[model samples]
Target: MRVFGMGSKAWLLNCAILFACPIAAQAAQDNGHGKNASHAAAGAHVHQISNHTTLASGAKVSHALHTASGKRVATRSFGISCVPYARQVSGIQVAGNAWQWWDNASGQYARGDRPETGSVLNFRANGHMHLGHVAVVTKVINSREVIVDHANWQSGGGVSHGVAVVDVSEANNWSAVRVELGREGTFGSVYPTYGFIYNRPDTGVVLASVSRPAPQPSINPVPSDLRPLAERPWRTMEEVAESPSTPRHTIDLGINAGVSR
Candidate 1:
């Protein structure tokens, strides 16, 4: 949970690396292209669904593609961003798009404004936050405040654990909140949010249970005829020859048995 500003030195180093590595720049550009394509597909799907459904609150619903397990399919790496970070810690496989998490979670996960442990608080895109942000609730202090763990809140990319977030909205609905800056216990800027995404198991598409091979019985019953062989004591060459129940073969005399000539 170390928080530090992206100093000029680090910035210059990053610039130099980007300038020197053409492959890295190309890869970043390709990733952006893929993200754009995914967003376009999600937008088209949302548009198609919106034409048939009518909203009671008149609020525009966000939409994104989801996996069969009800988790969002991420096209890129889950680095120092609130979306994938929350998803990783919360055990919720949500998509890469942070702004559309609430709408994408509709009927799949429980949504509310109240803070709960393991729930993801989804923020809305605003002037300060263009892509929106998400954080996993770690502890609920009271009805007014809670602690969360998120990433990339500071200049240098890293997780901010146990950061206090308070409901500062006029309605006290948790629609707006001010998160603590680092471990300073001081509230930062106010940011608007959609709501909290609860980790509910009962809803959404039920995944088929994987049938495992039944464990083999530990006590293997040996046949009575083989019991003597299983329990027989070790026999020397002379012992084997003397035993009436055993057969003997001529031993090779060339092999030495620790006896000096």
Candidate 2:
């Protein structure tokens, strides 16, 4: 295994894990319709492809998880109550498919090789880069619990949720995961701006154990986009708890009133 961040280099000798280093964009091509002959390690299991929103601020976002005909991909992210932002980053584009794949640097399918602790689960679009997220596989508990740590997750970075742990199973082909939203360590906010975990393969699981700093005052002014939500009535502790359903995915839960399915 190759490491990128934090100056530690340790190899997990069991399998050779090859990743597209630097996490940059690859050449573009039409999404996969052909069977990759060599790198058939089992394509990734996709969950759903629908969009998600922020719970607190009522912000809406979307990702590259759309179809060639421009349909919102179906995904289990919202259905299972697990945040889909990270999944979107991991290249699970179409919402309901649950099993898709993209090519790696060696021009093979993502799952062509066994994934490492901090591999960037990617989705391919016609041989080019379409979408993906940064995820650190935190655990491998009997195929029942494969905890992944990731942040800056949004439906295409539409809304931001902090890094979080999810329960995955191979039995379902890893298509669906049980997500733990608002689990404390997933996200961080600093006044008008926020920061989430980005693609950091060099520092995969090693950084998973690292804790985020407290939200600090930003040296820069807050962006104007957030002013309306930020200035909205501040909810008391009880008001917030009472209306918990109102803040799903940071979008005004009410925002989806007529729009939600």
TM-score of each: 0.46, 0.24
- Count clashing residue pairs per candidate: 4, 47
Model 2 bad stretches (over 4 Å): 1-101, 104-115, 122-132, 154-170, 184-261
105: Cα error in model 2, Å? 5.3
Tens digits of per-residue lDDT, candidate 1, 53-161, equal: 1123343222233346442222222248677688789987766588888788876787877678899988887655677888888777555566677877665555665
Scored by lDDT, the top model is 1
What is candidate 2's CA lDDT for residue 123?
23
